[model samples]
Target: MRVAIIHDELMRRGGAEQVVLTMLKAFPDADIYTIAYNSEGTYPEYKEYKEKINTSSFQIFSKSIKLMQKFYFPWGIIAMKAVKVTDYDIVIISNTHCAKYVNIDSKALVFIYTYTPFRLAWNPSSYSQYNNAKGVFKWIFDKVISCLKYIDFKAALRGDYFLAMTEETAQRIKDAYKVDDIKIIQPDVKTRNFYVSKQPGDYYLVVSRLEHYKKVDLAIEAFNELGLKLIVVGNGTKAAELKAMAKNNIEFKSGLSSKELADLYANCKAFVFPQHEDYGITPLEANASGRPVIAYGKGGVLETMIPYDVHESKCTAVFFNDQTAESLINAVKTAEHLIFDPAFIRKHAELFDENVFIKQFKSFVEEKYEEHSSSVIKSH
Candidate 1:
């Protein structure tokens, strides 16, 4: 059976890319497709798959038309649709953002890893850029978001099935697009490397992409008030600006491997997650490492972490009601009083172990194909 797995891009070995790789392992013979492949050397897991993956026709958009691509996402649709994939029996789209836009032939099952549809119109960067753009350019970006929101549904209708990574996203998909039928396929977090015996309980840590929505500034501001040391691990467009705002107790760090992140996860006094992340893996990492996570009680964290009475008996991690700095500070202060059970934290995180994700996802793909087979037989 010829299978084609589609991904938004392999820009980094982040949670989304990990899902695609796990899919490749499940269907070793399947051909993988992507719009870009920037994570070429960063992740060694795909060394053998280097030859099996299909590159997109929109290679230029990977670089030249990049920033503009967010607002003008149809350019990506036009770019990806050019690929000839009519021959495959199955086409699975693993997406956080853009893989859903790819066009494929009928008959193949289009299973999507449905992360919440980003609010394109209110997206901070595009909104900021649109507000500042001169004359016609300003109108163009604003129009594109509204236009793309419409196109998104037209494109979304392509999905034969939907796979939500978390319950929060499942609800969001239902609310955002009115699509309620969904199968939950959580991402994998390799826990073999993270063992918890001792922790570096001095500094609170945050590992994230440092995007505007991540609300890293909120983390920094809260920690600043608490006078607690904060070590942030990530680099993004907002990194420099965030670094500039860093106080004496706060430090901005980046470019750490998963192992290093796990170490921080295991050692940190507490993990600070201020973002309304789509589906953050770091919080899972913190849980797997037996570290308590301080997260906003919204978005992905709502599904991943638990609200606890105290630390020693925390269900998973704790969440603050609001995403603001003050709310985070209050949560952190309360967290300090709890007596955490390292074993319980690790055990809770095992629920989201990468192996489980792979097993469930593989079953979903294979099951959908089985359903597809029956429909074909009945039609004939």
Candidate 2:
């Protein structure tokens, strides 16, 4: 059967992009469709599949267009709507935004795998940029978001089946689209690429985009007060502001290869994850490296990381309840004193390996497609 994969954008190396890459492995022959793609900006592995990748009209612009794409929501919507996947037997959308609006053939089944309902449209208050806007700007922003939410909701209804990365995301999809039937298929980590190091490094590691919502600032503040070394990897809009806030003990690095990142995860004393994510991959990546995580005790992390307070023997992370630096500092201190078993951590992470996701996802699609075909035959 012919299959087509649609993703919102291939502009960066992120969890959602990773999911799309995994999907490609499941359906190697599937053509990929997206709103925008930046070869240099996103995963280098995508270059190998360049022949099968297709982008919208916006692809003519430079990479900077991705950063400003939020402002061109209407154009993005139009761009996706213009994409016709009418010939494919199955259209699997790896969506966090407008990809769901893509035109699909009535004979085909569309499976939408969401990272989360578009956060900027559904949960505006969570973004610092939205919260910092002025009276008129904020008013305009609110109105625009309201309109986008309506459009997003209508587009979501086109999916024959919906899948989410985590339970948190499943609930968000339910709230955003009022859709009751949803499947939860968590994303995976490349556990085999990582190994437990003989010796741990002196510095704590943070591998996340330096964004306002990521709460990287909290890690900087805690490390500054503790006078401990922190190595932060990844860059974003808040990069400059976060660098300015960090002290000499904090160091920033970006653009590391998969092997290099796995090495850092293997050697670091602990991985610091301050953000509340839809379903965090970094913490699991850390676990795959046989390292413990120091994370905020909320959101998707709760489902993955075994917290020390709850299950001391099985714990893979230390959880900080509050979002403040003081709370994180306390958790860091607690982590410093605890003994974590690298072997056990690695074993736990193996459950969410890339192969596992591929197997589960392919099975779900095949089973559902069979059911869909049977129904169509009955309708005739």
Candidate 3:
């Protein structure tokens, strides 16, 4: 079969990009289509698939990440519309943004693996930038989002099948697109690549993009008050502002290799995850390294982390109820008193291994394709 994979953009090595890379491994022969491609800005592994990767007319504007960020919405929609996938027998869209709008053959089986319905368009309140805007700018932003949401909803109807990264995201898809039939397929981690250290270091760890929504500031505040060591790994638009807010106890690092990150996970006392994510992978990565997680008790983490309960012996994390420093600090104190088993933590993480994701994803595609083929034959 002539298979194609369409992703929103290739500008950064975030969780969505990681899912795209895994999809590439599952369908090695499939040609990749994207709105943008930035070799240095994204994962180096993508270079291996350079020949099979194709971009849209927006590639010229996307060459600069800053320019792409400025005009990503309407331009993304236009660029995706221009991508012709009509020749392909199957088109799998790995979408968080606008890739669902790609033109495909009427006979092609199109599967959309979505991270979340376009958050900026459907849920503008979640974004700090959007909330910070005032008067005419906020009014214009809302008007544009309204238009984009309509377009996004129409694009969503084109998918022959839909897969969500988590149950939380599935509900979001249903609410945003009004699409009821959705499958939940959680993203996985390389559990085997991590190992438990016999001796953990004297610091907590955080591995996430320093974004406004991530709530890294809460961690900084909690750690500052506790006067404990914290090593934050990852950078983003909020890097400078976050760095300035952090005290001397909080150290920031970025651009570490996978191995380096795994090592940090292995040696840290515990992982700090303050954000409410669609489906978080960092907490699982920490658990894979046989470390406990101190996380906000909401969103996708609730599905992944086994919260500390007196009745549950397999608990791998302590949960904070709110996004405030006091709530997190109290959770940290509770975690300090509890004893976690590394073997059990690692075992829990193994349930969401990359191999499992590949197997399930491939099987689902093959089964659906066979059904589609049978239907096409009957139609003819």
Candidate 4:
């Protein structure tokens, strides 16, 4: 079967790109379609099989599609409408906000990696730099965003199937779109993370997009209470603001190699992830590095992390039930009290390894293809 994978943008090397690369490995011949790309050393493996399907004409004038993803749904339609997608028999969309854009085929099967798009996209504070303009340009942009999201939702009706990245997203797709037959696929973890061994490094580590909702400020507060060293990694508009508000325990660092960060992970006292995540990769990285993850409970943490009980002998990690300074401070203290076995921690992390994800994802996709084909024929 000829397959095509569609995505919003490939500017950064993150979790979604990793999922597409894994899919590329499974279907080496499947052509890839996206609005923009930044092919540094990020996707070296995909270079051999990867092909870009251009939609630049529409993209040039509407580059705001990505910037205004949540506020204006029209960016998805503007970007997606540019593609001539009637050719591929099977089209899989790796989506958060742009999944509704792929061209419909009678047999088109869209598997969306939705990370609570409604919440992520629409929250003004969570995402800055939207087209918050005025006059005719602002009015035009808002209208476009409004119309596009509506179209995107209607376009989803044409898709043969929907696959969600998490059960939370699946319920959302069902609730928002009345999509009944949603398939659940967990996010994949990078196995290379497990290569290092833990020895309780000097600084506590945090890695995520520096968004307002991530609550890096709360982490700063917690670290201040304990007087422990903390290292913050990631970039965003809030970086300067966060840097200014940081206490004596906190330090900002970015642009580290995977191996270098792995070393830090192996040595860190514990990993402090203050925000609730939608299939977060950093916590898994902490697990792989044999460093315990202290996450804010709620959202994907319940599914992805196995929180260590404060009393456990070989405690892996701890969770703060609430998103507060006091809760996180207590959780951090709990982690400090526990004695961890590096080997055991690393072993637990291996469960979400990339190879295992690849194998399972490949099997799942192939099985779905056969089932979808059979159903199509039966419908005739």
TM-score to native of every candidate shown: 0.90, 0.97, 0.97, 0.86
What's the TM for model 4? 0.86
Ordered list by lDDT, greatest first: 2, 3, 1, 4
Candidate 4 segments whose C-alpha is farther than 4 A from its true place: 40-76, 118-149, 310-315, 375-380
Model 1, 119-142: lDDT tens digits are 663253633355567788867776
Better of 2 and 4 by lDDT: 2
111-219 per-residue lDDT for model 3 (tens digits): 9999888888887888898999999999999899999888888988889899998788899988988889998888988787799999999899999988888899999
Worst 10 residues of 3 by lDDT: 61-70
Q: Candidate 3 — which residues are off by over 4 angstroms?
A: 61-64, 311-313
Deviation in angstroms for 353 in model 4? 1.7
What local lDDT score does residue 13 receive in model 1, on the 0 to 100 scale?
53
Q: Candidate 3's error at 300, in angstroms?
A: 0.9
CA lDDT of each prediction against the hidden true structure? 0.74, 0.89, 0.89, 0.70
Stronger candidate by lDDT (3 vs 4): 3
- Per-residue lDDT value at 216 in model 3: 94
Q: For model 2, what is the error of residue 123's alpha carbon versus the real structure, in angstroms, after optimal superposition?
A: 0.5
- In candidate 4, where is summed lDDT lowest over 10 consecutive residues? 120-129
Q: What is residue 170's positional error in candidate 2, in angstroms?
A: 0.9
Whole-model lDDT for model 3 versus the true structure? 0.89
Give the runs in model 2 whose Cα sits over 4 Å from its true position: 65-67, 310-313
Q: Candidate 2 on 1-380: residue-level lDDT in tens?
A: 99999998888899889888899999999999988788988899899899988887766552874344654567767877888777999999998888888888787899999988888899888889799999999999999899989889998888989999878889989999898999989899878779999898899999998788899999999999999999999998889999999999999999999889889999999999999998999999999999999999999898889889755557899999999999999999999888899989999999999999999999999999999999989999
Q: Per-residue alpha-carbon lDDT of model 4 for 54-121, expressed as tens digits? A: 44334443334236344334454565666666666677777665645655556466565555554433
